[model samples]
Target: MTLTKSLLLGTSGALLAVAGAQAADLPSRKAAPVEYVRVCDAYGAGFYWIPGTDTCLKIGGRVRIDTWYTPAKSAVQLRSTGGPAYTGVPGGGTASSTYTSANGIDQLGWYARGLLMMDARTQSGWGTVQTVVTLRLAAQTGLAQAGQLSSVPLAVAGTTGATIEAAYIRFAGFTAGQAASNFTFLPSNQYHSIWSPSFPSGIRQFAYTATFGGGISATVALENMGDLAAATTANSLGFNPYSATAATATAVAPQRLPALVGNVRIDQPWGAAMVSAVVLQNNANFATPGIQAVTNGLGPLVRKTGWAVSAGLRINLPMLATGDSIQAWVSYGVGALNYTAIPNLNANTATTANYTGGFLRGDRDMTIYCVGVGCASYGVEQAAALNIAGVFTHYWTPSLRSNLVGSYIRLTPGSTTRNTDWTNGGLSSATGWSVQTNLIWSPVRNFDIGIELSYARLQQSLTGLNGAAPTAVPCTAAAPMCNASISPSNWTGRMRVERTF
Candidate 1:
């Protein structure tokens, strides 16, 4: 009986132990902590992570607010400037009606600006693939206005889709989509001067790029064609040509094709160098409303084509650290320019000369160059723009840096002239230059504050103004209207603050 009882006790104990083990092995469900990546800078950092793959993701953005001060009378005069006669109302003028000034302080303003960028990449069995998207966001009231008591919204800032500044996909050694053009681009370099004044804007294009290792690459792009001068609303080469006609007819722009551009870049241990060319197609004789014409004509005449070629070099003085370097670039164009202002004037005569070096004579067609492409206005004419820019930068530390920049543009008018029933007009050769110096200090991580001082001089003459100044001849006995060929020059200064997340 004792033996049987012991056996039963042992069996019961063993069963109990097995039951405990089973209970402990039961699965328990719980949520895992979420993982994210973050960036911190004045330009704002991005957040990104792959959900199911090994690919890494990065996201970033920026917000900016700015204030400016200028002399009351220093603004550009709308009604008159020696370049083009104000046939309509006028454009930007003196700071009197446009800005607020108090206690010698010209004006104060703010802008809620932001940029968002996402980069995704993965290592695949075949090769590495990457995709990128960048955009800018801002409140309509972010931009300041001279006429309004407060600020007003800018229609163009966010009216488009998703603040798309750049979008592209890359595989192996090739990239395709919308991004910065290879032409006229400076690589692997950053300085205060690079961002001040007019920074190089991105463009939309279908491009192919080949990397040769060691910072050397070859690139080609087919991009949308337009003039830089059309930065203002409704002033682009794509505007309706009929709208420009004093008499209405049809609405047609100069070209319907894209531009072709290619570039080659080489980076050596000592410095970097790059060269590029672009070609554009132009229909010189198409007429459209609200469009400025290079010349006046009733029907479709000769086709126009334009082109641009540029090169640049940047060398690192071995003594100076990576932050300290010097760079320079030169660009020349011979056709439809991205930034030519169609002078507002009456082309009603056979030959119109501003009497400055500028002239718009009709038998010879006017040609504007764009990205190496050409757009012409029916006759044999040419316009050229030569630009030179240089900058030197010194980084006191990773968070602080200062730079000096100088740029010049020389525009030479060829045989371009416009004729109409009443008047004729054209542009004379002119030169403009700009110089800027700035100091950028980032007191905190992901935040930057800076002060900038810049000066610019733009000079233009009526076509006939190239010769000696016209004698002050009297137009009437009582009212002697002396034709003025000299346009006044302008200067500007700006201060800015930027934050990023």
Candidate 2:
């Protein structure tokens, strides 16, 4: 019995030892260390340090919805002409002669947009280096593309569009890539008002800003003018009698030089002020000077240069109320009408050359005319323009504010190069003005709702002053031809809601 007990004890001890040895040979279970994201306060709010790097990054975006209404007169004209159509009576007759009931007069429109932006910054030996990229997706309803003749659906329901608003880089006082120019100051009054001055929207360019102590800086840049002169000439003279001459004279000319832009700016406790200027080249080449028998032998035209200047001032009126301010600016251009904020003068669109005022009675930087047999010389008229805008803002409460804005623009074409009937009668001057007011409420951080009302008026030069002929339709006592000098005025109202982060 003693021998058996000893053997049993030895067997149990052997079993326990074998189990411990197996457990010791098994792999250990331990988790890897975590590298959590860290907040970065070095570069303002909303920035976080990238994992395992010193670079700071921020992501933000805005979503906006807008609804608006415009007068039937304006809407019909826009539908027929494809954009902001000239309001004066046509040479043949009144609105009845030019537009039909199918134009959908007095329409309401809505637009929704989503904007996304990413910013990355790092401190370098030279200075703080930064890169910014912004993208936009939009959907629209009830707004027709410029030049849609039929009542085709103008609304886009879903995210049917995308565009790059800005993509730029900055390092050591130098900015390169597509971005706003230094020439613009207080670019807009209310949200998306067309009456504001030409603010030189984002363009591909390189610029340098030099800081002078005391909140003063100067910038110089080279910007693409994008054949501005040729475009303006085409818009003024691309119809009927002048189409042939305009086509031959304003052929797409190669861009020889970029526009030179410069600005001086100062910021202070009171407000800010800036003076800006630009020089652009007006280059063109005639395609076939005397191709048609009627053109005679004129083939090539001379190249010209254009310039513009602007001055702006902003004054903080906190004494009146918190967030209160006033801003004013004026611009003058010679051969650069677009810089003066004239409608339909942008060079980016094919129909940009079309005028918002009526035909043969509006001004352009240049004009071309050919008439009668053996017309050798094409008219090349230099033009000048002026634009001014002012905005005043008042804060009723910490979360509520209102703005009043007004703008005026005038374009004067130079005297006819040729004393012919076509030159005299075909080209004239124009004046336009607009006023807008809006109230905006901010219910919470990064969110806003607003309402705006606006009015616009345009006046064209009278017919027959430049040897132009009167309308074919005779004047009636109720609406004399003389009254045709005024285009129909437009009134618009808008409501908007926006959220940002």
Residue 426, candidate 2: Cα error in Å is: 2.5
10 residues in a row with least lDDT, candidate 1: 344-353
Runs in model 1 with CA error above 4 Å?
1-49, 72-110, 140-162, 186-201, 226-254, 284-302, 339-380, 418-424, 465-487
TM-scores, all candidates, are 0.66, 0.77
* lDDT (C-alpha, whole model) for all candidates: 0.47, 0.59
* CA lDDT, candidate 2, residue 267: 95
What is the C-alpha lDDT profile of model 2 across 284-366, one tens digit per residue? 44333356344552345546677889999999999999889999989888876655554322211111112122233332344
- What lDDT tens digits, residue by residue, belong to model 1 across residues 28-49? 7789966654332322234344
